[model samples]
Target chain A: MAVSQRALEAAGLGGGRGRLERLRQWREQEHVFGYGLILPALVLLTCLVAYPFGMAIYFSLSDYWVGSPGQFVGLTNYREILGNDVFRQTVQNSFVFTGFALTLKTLLGVWLAVLLARDVRFKRVLRGAVLLPWVIPTALSTLGWWWMFDSLYSVVNWTAIRLGLISAPGPNWLGQTNYAMAAVIIVNVWRGLPFFAITVLAGLMSIPREFYEAAEVDGASSRQRFWHVTLPLLKPVLAVVILFSTIFTFSDFNIVQILTRGGPVNTTHLFATLAYQIGLQGGNLGQGAAISLFLFPMLAMVVFLQLRYIRRD
Target chain B: MASAASVRARRLRAALTYANLTPFVFFALFPFYFMFVTSFKRNAELYNLKAVPFWIQTGAITDHYDFLFRRTEFLIWMKNSLIVSVIAMSISLVIAILAGYSLARLRYRGVGSFGTAVFITYLVPPTLLFLPLSQVVNWLGLSDSIWALVVTYPTFLVPFSTWLLMGYFRTVPREVEECALVDGASRLQTLLRIVLPMAVPGVVCAALFGFTLCWNEFIYALTFVSQSGNKTAVVGVTADLIRGDIYYWGSLMAGAVLASVPIVVIYVWFLDYYVSGLTAGAVKG
Candidate 1:
């Protein structure tokens, strides 16, 4: 009974204690300190990300431009964008571009990661070399690609001709619709493949070697071992990587903007570049806001799925 | 006989693997190689149909480098990029260290949801936010200033740094902090004195990633800063180099090469941390 009473006093659970009151006060201070520590980050995030997100949605519904105040005009901007031919084409183009680029990146990333995980000679050098496209800024690297794909001075064409692969100058890459799309997608894959390879390689490294050893001892072939042990273990990491990459690829701006600038009859305009065109350049802020918001629903679905997966873990 | 056939098959498989890897390696490195080679090529060599495209002509000229330095605002852009990247990185590290420590160590309500919120914000790509963010920048009267990029970059950087740091902080043994607490150390002192020193690699990783991100930022820098002197390398190179119907290929290549050198050097120096930091966030998240 005495020990219980003393413990209560120490915790300030008993009324009107001296040192125990100071202890309670210190605990309260710590509680407030937690909030204080998070306050700056929270405030900054609200101003930069959260507030802008809300304004983007509001701007989508208003007739806001660069210089003029906007009037609320619900669904008008969305309807027009949905109905417009350029916007429609861009919507299709964004999907195609993201889909093809991501598919290729995933395949190549897995293959590269598998190779990298092996005990190859000069492995560190090879890994560093492979990551060059990713570490360099996309805009700068894409510029190099732009020069390489120049209609008249294309290096690719010169090499192809020398190798007897083509008899004539290569087609203008960014001047044609399909070729423009292909060029942008190619650059996107090149830059993005390293991300997948590195992340998947990390995933591959985390799997216990004993699992592979056990499988081999059970008479499993390399292919069978990969299917049974590696794929299942890699699924979680792959899910997270794919989800993140999809969101990124869908919102990609630099690659398209730098390479194609939504050129060749606007066949390469993703949501971002199209928004930049209409909002900033064309002075139609409301419409641009709406166009950018088109990505929101799709990405929100992805974020929701990702959150659920993370929570389950 | 079976063993010999299997050995031959393995050899063949190894050859095929190398064959598959060769093209990918070539594709990955070719653009950079082309950029370097073309940067040094004389304008005459660049235009000549008879010259080989892959190799630079003997006694290649540095006229493009001369042009980039003398005729363009390349140096000013480099300074601007350095200034903005450093400021943004410092601010991001400070905020992320506090926020990450709080989320990872402090006992508090709503930390789980708060951490998730930060992750979700990270997921909110800059593309969706840039339009409204531009308006906000205008409102702050920061457009056309390096401060615009310095302030805006933290939106992406803080969340990423915090997320990475949170993972790092979690890996730290909790008993160390508890012992400090028992020794009558405040949380702040403990974090600064004890935890931070132990977490140097994590902090360095965060700093490197954050700095590289700020250096690489494009769309905001492109949109917010239009003045020639204020533009960063990526934006300036794209805008000023390509005149309509006349691509200054050599100078553009030189500019690209110059812009990439600092980042490439950093990547080479910190390759392991770069790879692990990148993958740790994804795998952990």
Candidate 2:
């Protein structure tokens, strides 16, 4: 992250006594230049990011609504939301959605990665195919999933019935609570799977091949090699991916918004979607702000651990 | 006999690998294929419960696409999406290049704190702040316009692009930049003229990802812009197309296909850069 000190000294050694020299003299003060360079980024982020973030906290604490003058209410919004059953359902739904999605993503991701890392033909094409789900926009792709899960023309149910996996007119996917959750989870897993596969593939590619040879030298089976050599070395990458995925999954909005709109008795509402429903559509700015702000503490803990984990390395 | 068995085992493992990958590939791509095929099938075939839903047996037609263009504001939304993505990506890249160079190459006092600030800012998800941001946008008179998206898209884009570019900028040799400095080139001049050229790939990588993010963003675009003409493609397709409970499946799929095609095409061409950006964001941490 630095130019050599010798280079700085060498830069300072240049001699001149004119405007060009003044400019050269200015170059030696590198930190000033660095500060100057970073200012625009700082300004933009402060106004757009930090200010809005601060306002979010302020919003949750006040009795605010869209276009209404909000007055400080000191946790009243939080208390009201805490008493709400729909909000409670939302918290449970978020955890359930995240729990199922992350578990599947991790297991499938590592397996797909190991498979991708193998010496296979058309590797680039295969890798590209696997990564396609992630490249497409979620709102659009989830619409595709929504079409497949349609109550009447549900191809998912159609295939299931044809294959004898379920009975005719199979479960009302978006209309029934359990089926709706499953449909959303399935789409989430479908959308999020490639992210896991590709990232883990990168981690797999980074491991030294000699580790495998060394394991085999000691008479290790392929399973043993994976368990002992690959999985342990992959832990750091896995942890980071999990943490990031947890944050992404917890804060997810588009999938639920498009697929169910937290339908069938709000059985599948995530915090973001709940916040949208309550805050924007319901026009309860304080409650919406509070609902979303609830995610902050948990995610901040994840980010903290993430920073600590990365820093330790 | 042992040599023959070992060869057979190798062949067996090879077959197993593809077999395992088959389902994953299908799971990953079948929805897209479904979307594409559904977009083309005529309404009669699509709604015929007796017909096989997997393929277009009644021959492909562009009627849905024709209806989308003729009846809906699909073209306006796409044009808006393009405008927002281009403007936001360009601004984020410029800011990210400077910030990335600063954090990666400069050893100034408080540089560590600034880096942490960017890191902290990057972790602040848009979901959490969209409510307050909507208020902010209202105050700025950018409500119901693409201008709101253009302004706010950079919040997420800049931190990510800066973080990604920070890792990328670190990989460029310090000697080249230092050499440029020692030769009496100003740091700004050195950065702009010498170091930036070498870091073009990083810039392009950031640009590609930055553009993808802007195009793919939904919540802010959905929350910020309400006008049909100002809605980004993703938001417009979802918010406007499906009226009441009657989803125009064929035309909806068409809208989905049209909205997703540009970014998908871009990603297919630069798959490597895109993956590297993904890894740089997650793995590098």
TM-scores for every predicted model: 0.94, 0.95
- Candidate 2 accuracy as TM-score: 0.95
> What CAPRI grade goes to candidate 2?
medium
Put down candidate 2 lDDT per residue, B5-110, tens digits, no spaces. 9999999999999999999989989999999999999888998999999999989999999999999999999999999999999999999999999999999999
Stretches > 4 Å off in candidate 2: A1-24, B1-4, B245-247
lDDT (Cα, 0-100) at B182 in candidate 2: 83
C-alpha lDDT of residue A11 in model 1: 86
lDDT of 1 at B40: 92
Q: Give the Å shift of residue B55 in candidate 2.
A: 0.4
The window of 10 residues in a row where model 2 chain A has the poorest summed lDDT is A1-10
The TM-score, computed over Cα atoms with residue i paired to residue i, of candidate 1 is: 0.94
